[model samples]
Target: MNIPNLLSTMRLILSPTIIWLFLRDQTLMGYIIFGLAALTDILDGFIARKYNVRTKLGTVLDPLADKVLALSVLFTLAMKEIIPYWIPGILAVKEMIMVAGGLFLWNKGVVIPANIFGKVATASTYAAVLGSYVDRTIGLYGLILTVALSIVALFSYGRIFFKEKV
Candidate 1:
């Protein structure tokens, strides 16, 4: 297993730990788990490039893990009302659209690479979620950053999709 892929796998493994800790009302511990998980995300990409050990499985697993984690965090936030109810609704729509695009591309044998915008969006989201978990002091800024990144990421992704396969 490549180092980057290994780090991604660890993030996947930590997702459940974060959920468990958060559900148990252990906010501080949950933040710790989330921090470590987020760190793994940062390390994975770095190691992937530095060691030049990228793989197809990593391509698939990494995004799926991100979606899973995002959904989990969003669910918790919605329940806590830290985010508006429609936030999840819109996010779900976005994910579904992306998944459909990915499936279409995969079926056509076009290996649509993971764009950097998507990575920025994911990192921003994790930061916002973790910020909310820790304290609302920085959470507002985190959310602001997340919204900016998501807009750029999704817009860029849409541009690529429309340009290449539309």
Candidate 2:
């Protein structure tokens, strides 16, 4: 695997550890690990784009890692009563649809890259997750924004998929 792909793999590995830490009531440790995993997400994308070492595997793995990390953390936060269950519930549905759509496109040898909407939605998701640690109200607004943006991204991806599939 290339460096970017390796970093994505690291994020995938760290996600469950972050969830475990949260489950054990180690919020601070979980946040630190979450930050590291988020850093890997940024670094991998930057390195892949800058070095032009993008691969089919990296394309799939990068976003899959991001989705897994974000969804796992959101679910853990909801389980801890730090955030409402509906927030993760909506996100889970959105992500599931996205995953299904992505797989369909992948089967047809099409890989749609992340657009600006998706990037903002992901950043908003992380912010929302972190905000829940401060104030539930702040987190709620952030999550609302995240959900709206995620839906927009979902539609955008769907549009791209149909365009490419044709």
Candidate 3:
């Protein structure tokens, strides 16, 4: 309902459309839509923080939107042979582990916020996705960088949540 949440919702809605375009070989349109969705991601966070209209819904929807957008594009590109499977595979596994870890922590009444490493990984993934349209080499390097950052993020989150318990 709020502006921030609405923006997040827009990104969510746009995810499948972007994927559809990509799968259909509409690279330009896919990239444009993806860029717009990314813009919404930035705007939603800024608006939520600046206008003090942050909501729990926004908190949940924003990350969900980000995951859907990033993963969808990656999968589509991999399917089209535009990017290697290993890249999305690594990113996907990292995300799965992170989600499982988050759930475990939540069950134990711990809340771990997204850290800088995760943000860096996400930004790298976005770059990789965009770069695929320009040059596969750029995309490949970006994905490699993202995978590295994701590993660090996994370790960072694990350290944060498991340090006290272990």
Candidate 4:
């Protein structure tokens, strides 16, 4: 695997570990590990784009890794009563729709790259997860922003999918 792909795979693997740490009441450890995993997401994308080493696997795996990590963290936080359950619930449903749409587009030989809105949403989500460790209010606001941006991203993706599919 290329460096970018490897990084994405590492994030995917680290996700469950982060969740485990959070579940075990290891917030500090979980936060540190989660930060590292989030860094991989940024690094992998940068490497892939800058080096022009983007692959179909990287294209798919990168976002998949982000989704898994973000969703898992949100779910874990909710389960721990650190965040509202509806936050993760809404995000889970949104992600499921995104995955299904992405799969359909992939079958049709169309690959839609992540847009700015989606990037911001993912970043905000990471911030929210991190902020939750510090202050619940900050986390709540961050998640609210994430949900809004994610909805915009979903619409943007849907627009692109239709435009390309047609």
**TM-score leader:** 4
Residues 70-165, model 4: lDDT tens digits: 999999999999998999999999999999999999999888888898999999999988998899999999999899989999999889988988
| Residue 55 CA displacement from its true place in model 3, Å | 3.0
TM-scores, each model vs. reference: 0.87, 0.96, 0.90, 0.98
What candidate 1 gets wrong by more than 4 Å, as runs, is none
Report the lDDT tens digits of candidate 3 across residue range 15-93.
9999888888888999999988988988988898899997755766787788889988888888999888887788788
The stretch of ten residues in a row with the least summed lDDT in candidate 4 is 108-117
TM-score preference between candidates 1 and 2, better one? 2
Off by over 4 Å in 3: 163-166
> How much does candidate 1 score in TM-score?
0.87
lDDT of 2 at 124: 91
Count clashes in each candidate, considering only residues at least 3 apart in sequence or on different chains.
Answer: 0, 0, 0, 0
Cα-based lDDT at residue 145, candidate 1:
71
Q: After superposition, how far is residue 71 of candidate 1 from its true place, in Å?
A: 2.2
Best by lDDT: 4
- Tell me the tens digit of each residue's lDDT in model 2 across 64-116: 99999999999888899887889889989988888888898889888888898
